[model samples]
Target: MAGSDIKQSLRKLDFPLCARDALYQIEKLCTRPGKQMELQIDLMSEFVFGEIERRRKRNVPAAIQELQLIEVQSDFFQSPGGIPAVRNALFLSLYPAGSPRYKILGNLVSLAITIHNKAVLNAAGIWMQQLGSTSQESVGLARHILNDYFVLTSKSVDRLQQLPILTPHFTANLLTAIGEVYKDKNPPTEVLRLIGEWINDNPSLLLTSLMDNPALPTGGIPMTPITPIAGLFRWCILSPVRTAAEGSTQNEDEQKLYSKIQHLLMDSVLRLKSSGSNKHAISAQHLAATTRALTLVLQSFSNIEPTSRDLAMERLAQAVSSAMSANCIYGNKQELLLLLQSLSYQHFLIEWTLQTYSTKAV
Candidate 1:
């Protein structure tokens, strides 16, 4: 009869009931023995939030302080085994995993924040480790929960980038999600390796996409060193040198062939600068542009070059130091300065020994 009466009273009570009465009821339920702890917990949370809203409406400091205190206490309260009776009851009745009030659902934002926190990364890592296990049913459940959490959170990519264990999963997931978001009709790669393959297979397409901007004005081949051209040139120069050292080619014949290719590039640069074939001239121009840009960048290579024995080294050092202080490396600023000082002094002396053998014409 009392239970029926209580239910009737609860139904009759207006939502957002009198704050004083609500607070009193909530507090009493929280303190009383044999009370349904879940009801108390949920009611308390709601009441506290209500009080916070009320205070915020009135600009009440007391209400703000109370809300902050509640948040702080609740952080610790939500830990494992704080109030299992209340937690279990709430988890089942209101806050079930998918339920709006379930602890997992209720604190989705908080869980994401915890997942990203460096101090708590290990804890999250444990959760991920447990999730990745094949034998555990909880693993699949936890993985789904985390995947949802990551998808919803704004900091998902940043968090995943920071977490080494999640890097592979996040990269794969992000590419798919990005493709969907942009409606990328043809998505690129499942992994970074696959990205390299795509680039290798479709180099001209990659170049065209990058260079197709209206800002580029593709009426004729651009005379100016554009970013796309410069990037390709830099990669071409650096890639072979870095990759083709010892085990790069299949056999000695291939190595010798590549070595001849290297001599050809340098020879072409010199010949282009002197004789000025359109393609080779453009190549030389790019080299000059790059040297001008990177003369100052070479300061980062201070350990590689020493000033003790070489006068050329000392002059180069001074030019680099001046460029560093000025913060300009491009457009012949550092290059001209270095050339006027160190390079102008070097005299070129070339000698070639030619051996000729007379052979009968075939």
Candidate 2:
């Protein structure tokens, strides 16, 4: 009878507020001098979050309500592993793998961005990384987000690009989402175009999945000097999406769109590497990363036009020479050496790259 009464009381309580207060009090108690032991703090935290998780399962409607309410409350997600329990519960209940509530995701994502809550964004990013890989819900969510930017059209860069949160915090997860969405079928040109625009906007899109990526866009493609993040541009733009059969209109459009993506990426790399002479403009890491990225992009397409290929290789050689003259080989020489070694297969780069490669550390 008391258990039944507990359920009745839980349904009526302001669980989000109560949970927040509970966390705040626990923090105080744990921090008070001589009030708690070191291990005790962790134990208390786990107990509190564990109970919250259980309560969410027992009353999902209440969990969903808390999910919305917690967003407005300051310091709600501050407690480590404290608030994500509620988030996970709500997502599982509201967005089941089979049948998710699509309409709710936009407002949730948009609100998350509008409020500019770092904790909330981080939680969402990590959550997607964990569950999004196999979940059907993630694929649908990706489509919904992508659709908001570009519709299925062959003509247009004329529309306003309303990409709010383009950070790898969310975009990295899109890798999994993209995989699930187009696992079996050919990639649509519209999607390729949408991502190309994103590459132009997000400079460090590849740096994460680094501890987490830590961007908005106004106009030109900003140079991405950071290595892994620049590599991310290479990964997404050159992703091996399924292609349509040859001679078909679908194949032609997809290839044309993909070529544009490649060019955009190549240009970004070229700009950053060329900037290697301006130590203020680019880093030692820049030339190494960009050189490797361009090589990988070059290798991916066997049929890349000779003119473009030759021009790219020639530009790369100049950039390397310029960067070397600027002493790019001194710093990050270990990393630079590894990258150059990896590119030995690209014999066109073998000339200066093989004989000219030097390390300060050596």
Score every model by TM-score: 0.22, 0.42
What ranges in model 1 sit over 4 Å off? 1-42, 51-74, 77-158, 161-362
Clashing pairs in 1: 95-101, 95-102
Q: Which 10 residues in a row give candidate 2 its minimum summed lDDT?
A: 240-249
**What is candidate 1's lDDT per residue for 16-76, written digit by digit as tens?**
3423233445434533565555555544444434323422334446545444433433443
Instruction: Give the per-residue lDDT of model 2 (tens digit) for 276-295.
Output: 44233224564566566556
Model 2, residue pairs in steric clash: 207-229
Candidate 2 is scored at a TM of 0.42
lDDT of 1 at 66: 44
Best by lDDT: 2
lDDT of 2 at 262: 55
Give Cα distance to truth, residue 282, candidate 1, Å: 61
In candidate 2 the C-alpha lDDT for residue 187 amounts to 58
